[model samples]
Target: MMNINEHLLRTFEARPGEFLSGEELSATLQVSRTAIWKHIERLRQEGYEFEAVSRKGYRLVAKPDKLDVEAVLGRLHTRVLGRSIHYMNEVDSTNNVARELVQQGAQEGTLVVAEQQLAGRGRLGRKWHSPKGKGLWMTLILKPRIPLHFTPQLTLLVAVALCRSLRQITSLPIGIKWPNDLLIDGKKISGILLESSAEEENLNYVVAGVGIGVNLLPDDYPDDELRAKATSLAIEAGHTMDRSEILVAFLQELESLYDIYHEQGFGPIKLLWEALSVSLNRPVTCQTPKGLAEGTSLGIDESGALIVKLQDGTVTKWYSGDIQFSS
Candidate 1:
């Protein structure tokens, strides 16, 4: 069966800045005029604005500022990432949805994106601020053949991609915090979370959840603590940004990095990651399951572990935990 809504959207997309009559759309869609009208209504409910005339048909005048499925899909030049997408206006979490889809045999490179997340979560299961149409929230599924223990590497890889995207689109100073937090001048701008579904000793699939503050304003972060540390591209750039552009940019960079990772190895990716890292060569505090330690980040290793030089001149490799810069 044809997806009447998606096809209808494509028709308008092809003829941008133009209007079509009901008869023309009906003839093109091979459906009744009523069906075309219904489809247009559906698009409107999805944040699309149509200018309907008395005799002439509808024209797409405006689109949502967030990541529209058709818009993102059309703009992507990637081969593996973002080929398949499941879009929702609002959801509990894209990661949760992607996991369910994975169980139902969703292929690798499948993406689940939303305009808003009702119960979004960040690292340590903390609440993630995902305002409607104010940021980008999505989860991408991958089924790499790497070991399950190496899944953490994907997080850093994504951070590199995201940081590259921001750098390309804006002039603000952008860098990656250890692991996968993206910061613009020491303020948080983005986060990445990786969840994998694996068998006893093998990996089945990995869900890389990404959340970015694209066009968020100061009003969005009313919390005093959040306002001090959290920021958006718009806030830092002093202008509004299109979330769709950032969405496509991130996907393209991620696809390229993923290819490099598969074709060569993690060495190249580690180097790229180190180049964009803000924690390296700086005083840092690490909190691991074992205990807390202060050190200077030397960079990551081939296996994606943090190499830190402790205060006592002792060197150690941290395999797991979170690290925060002292300064």
Candidate 2:
């Protein structure tokens, strides 16, 4: 069956705020008038509010005040990141939706974005605050042919891209907090989560989900303790930001970096990531599931693992761990 919602969305965008006659819609869609009515009802049920005038027709009054697909796709300048966008007004999670689509054979570079997530998550399975119309919750699917071991490079690539993009767009002193978190003045501002599907010798795809605390007010965070540890770009910048613009910039940066990684490998990107890394040359304590270790952060290896120089002048490589700076 044809996707009625898709058809309605396209029609609404083509003739926004203009009356679209039911008969004309039926004729154009080649469906029965009953089907057109049913689709209209479904769209209304899905939060699309329209004005039906007597004998005039249906005029799209207001769409859900969420991330408009037209607005986001219009601002996108990349050929891939937003070529296939699945925008949701309210979803459980963009990563969850992206995973389901990947299972259904969705192509690489497909993006799933949600204005609000009921159960958004971060690394280590922590709950991410995703209030409505406040933050950017998005997931991008990538099917790189690279080996499974090289997947960590993707996280590093995203971190660098986000830091650079934020620096260019906002007047915040954004810095990377080791592995994947973006921080401004020692508080969390954004995070990146990379989940991949791979077999022993081959790789299927990678879902890189990024959640940015953009335009969220301090009061938006319900928990007092959590609010103290988290901050948003809007709060830091003291004004509301166009989340669509930030999304487009981040996607463009990701695409550019991905192209570079695919063509030249992680060598050049690693250099850039290290240059922007705030952990390097700083005193830090690495907390792993095994134990706690203290060291002076040296840099990252070619595999994207962190290099820590211990007090004994011995350098150790860490694959994965929660890093805490010791001032």
Query: Which run of 10 residues does model 1 get worst, by summed lDDT?
Result: 64-73
Candidates' lDDT values, in order?
0.88, 0.87
- RMSD per candidate (Å) reads 4.8, 5.4
Give candidate 1's TM-score: 0.81
Distance from true position, residue 137, model 1, in Å? Answer: 0.2
**TM-scores of all predicted structures:** 0.81, 0.81
| Model 1: lDDT to the true structure | 0.88
